[model samples]
Target: MANRHGPCMEKKCSWCCDPVKVPANFSDEKIPLDKEGKRIWRDREEIVVPESQMETVRLKTFDCDLLDTQTGKCSDYENRPEICRNTSCVDEKSTKSVDEQHRETLEEELIPLKGKK
Candidate 1:
């Protein structure tokens, strides 16, 4: 389910701009769920961009592997991965602020880059 409050108020979320890998078969009709009615987990690959290739990495991208770049929206909003559906910056109860959480998550998932010019 997409955010009930509507599209995120933040300009954009880092995760949406650079999503992690998803299963090829991901879709609303075929989402994998566990016996407890929870979505199944899949391993995610790190997104790495060498310092030399920084220019090649698009910032504020909407071209996530699973998103519709033109609209800057998830291609499969109804059946998007649980993580995508659950993360929300607008929810005040959230411990870490949106920027903080996003940065932490990106740091963990994005591989360390080498020397920069």
Candidate 2:
């Protein structure tokens, strides 16, 4: 089975493909602020697929605008956004621990989008 980071080296798997949902605050659009002017993050739900079932399950929730469904690849891999560059599908306990730290780092990189819609 491919790690949760993504597909194995040679073969291409649709593990990270179209219709996958992401946090609404993932974009550069302005995040709504609450009454106290606190950033209101989207109520993003995490999909925790068990490592054993990663390959067998058909994910139909990928919402990434950059995915190329025809080729089963990212349209702009070289210049893909930071979030895309950092994500993986490899599933291991040790990797998960590392990924957790990495996720925190990514979250820190987010600059709240200013200006209202």
Candidate 3:
């Protein structure tokens, strides 16, 4: 639960290790980042066509880890994929709203699970 603008040590994924890119994680599609470290994902939006491999790839969540422990160092550091190695996250930015979002998402999901209709 690190502030998007806080120090790296202060901010970390709550679900996984630190951001670690291995050889396999690298990809030609380099993720662009803003000065504050926010990723520019707009370019791919237009390119993801319907029922294409790229479209399928788009469905895959790139969120590395939700915890601090699983980010900087790869879980499979020795055998990570190139695409994973090249993946990047907005570390410098304060995706701080995450906490709020997480809570809201969970609440929404739970409502469905509770069969409260």
User: How many clashes show up in model 1?
Assistant: 0
Provide the lDDT at 2 for model 2. 31
Better of 2 and 3 by TM-score: 2
> Per-residue lDDT for 1-117 in model 2, tens only?
233454422344334343343443354343334457654333323333323344333211234555576886666555655455455544445545544644443343222222421
Give lDDT for model 1: 0.45
Give the number of the best model, judged by TM-score.
2
lDDT (CA) per prediction: 0.45, 0.42, 0.32
Q: What value does the lDDT take at residue 80 in candidate 2?
A: 50
Q: In angstroms, give how far residue 34 of model 2 lies from its true place.
A: 27
- Residue 13 miss distance in model 1 (angstroms): 6.5
Estimate TM-scores for all models.
0.34, 0.37, 0.21
Per-residue error at 98 for model 2, in Å?
14
lDDT of 1 by residue, 22-78 (tens): 333344344445457654333232334434345554211113455565666555666
Alpha carbon deviation, residue 1, candidate 3 (Å): 25
Q: Output the better candidate (1/2) by lDDT.
A: 1
lDDT, candidate 3, residue 23?
24
Give lDDT tens digits, candidate 3, residues 1-117: 323332223333322122222222335266434457665223221211113232222221233432224345334433434443333333335454644544432243111112111
Off by over 4 Å in 1: 1-15, 19-64, 94-112, 115-117
